[model samples]
Target: MSLAPRAVLVHRTTEYEELLARHGTAGQAAFFLTSRGRDLEPVAARHARARRTLAAVEAAVPLHWRRARVERADLDRFLFGPEDVVVVVGADGLVANTAKYLTGQPVVGVDPEPGRGLGVLVRHRPADTARLLTAAVRPDAAFDELTMVEAVADDTQRIRALNEIYLGAPGHQTARYRLATATRPDPAAPEESQASSGVLVGTGTGATGWLRSLWRERSGPPALPAPTDPRLLWFVREAWPSPTTNTTLVQGALTNGDHLRLVVESDRLVAFGDGVETDALELTWGQTIRVGLADLRLRLLV
Candidate 1:
């Protein structure tokens, strides 16, 4: 028989700890919060609850499987194998953060604070860890296969996103990139190009996120990606109409097997997945980035 897959618990630092780390002392942090009309009690309470939830989750793990805990900041250093299941012990954003590094592994999102909105990805409470983990490892497990987006650069540097992939400058300055896209579902369609501020390629799971805000601004937002839709939505931000640049190809959808390509006409451009800027791919002039639906899907346990 095969060994039980390891359950990797992922979490991040709480607001309380971040404040203390910045202020160097609890007393100093409290004083700083008071000056800003914020109290430390609420933050402390939330952090305490998170701790309890983590304890319960770890204790609930079965003995046959190896258990490991990792902080969100340390995810890049941690090694995950095919026989491992990832458990995110935070809000939906944490799930998005954890999904980029994953390759078709089952992910269980635990809402540490049940009172707050759990978001679609995190469907279970901390108390549900044991049962969820057990179901996740089974062959007959029922899961929502969430779509993911990918960006590959000329240098071969690649990244994936469960929510969205942002391509822009570090400081939000004017980003100059010549964009061309081939709508995969319609191969006979000719590719087009444009110069713009930046590009945003998102999945169906990201419809309600940053992409949603952009969608709301337009009289008609292209139908947002559905949770199981094997397609990606692409939008160019503030496409500048210049004598040298065409603004006609500002928005489109990239179906599965199709890709959107961008040539960095500017000196520099950066690509980050799911809002994690630290983990990014940097490109220079003449570099090409291809965006499309990723081969791996996030199997989120409901």
Candidate 2:
């Protein structure tokens, strides 16, 4: 007596033929998420996998892949218009890739990444690794309006950006600190607190990539909002103080109210973005620079 319609996905669904058949009937469109040419070349003689299944899938469903943006050719094909009933074989790239291309259609992340089952890391399963961490992400508004990419946004599906945000220093030199504030020309006077090295601020979508790691030390992991609540700023660095200082100011104060200030005693200070050199911000023993969330946001297709 149920009237809801269903669709089948055939990317890695070689074993779900019956299920596919059930969903493919009654004039409903089936959606399949496949590697296209992204799949590794098959062996010289073995075609026992979904190669034939994919061909049958072509006959089964009218593929509605992403094609929304030139930069997202790989992902754009997967996103369908809002009125479509969609099913997809989601993986790391597929899920993250789907964010920019989804057309507001109701979609099921089918054949998702083995570990998480579904959500975020959809179907990126490894042949060797069994356990993997999964997180949801959106986009940063600061860079969304950009027509061309001058600087690759923080969450550009690039692995390097995530690694820099989560991983700490190699040895134990300590993540040094300088003030990240709004005031120009920096601060003076040592009356406040000692600044720690690089702190990271995140929107909700970025919470899983960097905030979760820092939460292990300070706050616990919260839900993934489009951009998290109260806005997140992370202090990532390996420069733990030598215990010689009198007072250490962690996530200190700022005049902007929402911002934070860091005061380090040493002049060997630098401001790095993610993990690259941003600029050599010269500072005195006591100075204040404001740090707060930027007025930007991102939209993700889920």
Candidate 3:
């Protein structure tokens, strides 16, 4: 017999909870914020809303459907089953963060504090949970397939992100690497050695975040891709020009078959996706990685 559909509710620790944990009590937490000229009432209210949202979503799950709850910090260790229907409750970033761990499961993003967020990914509210959960379990349900980017190291370490990926030093120092692209029509072009802040490769869903700020700073020809576009954009941040390095190749787009290749020249470099640094791939000197569109897309329930 086939397994019953499962609902996996995902959430993160709230600011109020963090404050209480650090200060040891709600009164102390309020005092700490008050001393800093900040109000704790808003934080506490938001936390209450988040808790209520989670409870409503959980209650909406059918009793016959298996269910599980996962905190954002534990996503890296969570094992997602093939029949899982993911429900992420929080800001839009939480959806992006959860997208990296999933395969093709239909995801329903629920916003706890609605107007405060961008409302791009977390587009649903707590009241919509029961209906959305029913739709999500249907094999014929409609969903938007959002693009994702992936970086695969030659050693086989790979990472995927729904928003964008960052490759750079783990510290404040510059990242040293040799950059090249396979999409160039002229195959004989030489790779450039770069010494800069880092490299950023993002998807269309990412265009609303860090990629949008970069796009606004320049007059561009290749426009940013749509949320479901199969293309990706790469930018080399603060590419410095020196005797040994060049800044000519700073930005470009990667289509379906295109890839950006980076060979580590520094002693150590790190590659992280969706701003999750703890779950990242560390590369040493001479390691090579190729960044491109991931085969797996985020099936976001509309």
Query: How close is each model in CA RMSD to the real structure?
Result: 1.8, 14.7, 1.4
Model 1 CA deviation exceeding 4 Å by range: 185-193
Instruction: Report the CA-based lDDT of candidate 1 relative to the real structure.
Output: 0.86
Writing each residue's lDDT as its tens digit, candidate 2 over 1-302 gives: 43222232414323244434555632221233122332112221123333443333334342332212122233323434443333445443343333333333333343322454435533332221111111111122111210000111222321112112221122223434443332323445333323244455443444555555665565343443343243444444333555543223333221222444455445434332233332223434444343444332222223
lDDT per model, in order? 0.86, 0.34, 0.92
Model 3, range 247-295, lDDT digits (tens) per residue? 9888889998789999999999999998888899999999999999999
Considering lDDT, which of the candidate structures 1 and 2 is the better prediction for this target?
1
TM values, all candidates: 0.95, 0.37, 0.97
Candidate 3 Cα deviation (angstroms), residue 209:
1.0
Full ranking by lDDT: 3, 1, 2
10 residues in a row with least lDDT, candidate 3 = 181-190
The better candidate by TM-score, 1 or 3, is: 3
Give the Å shift of residue 185 in candidate 2.
12
Q: Summarize candidate 1's per-residue lDDT along 1-302 as a digit string, tens digits.
A: 87678999999999988998999998999999999999989998998989999999999888888989999999889888888899999999999999988888899999887768746887798888999999998889999999999999879999999999999887768887766665653545554455666888888899888888777776666788797899888888887777777777777888867898888878888999988999999999889889998999999987
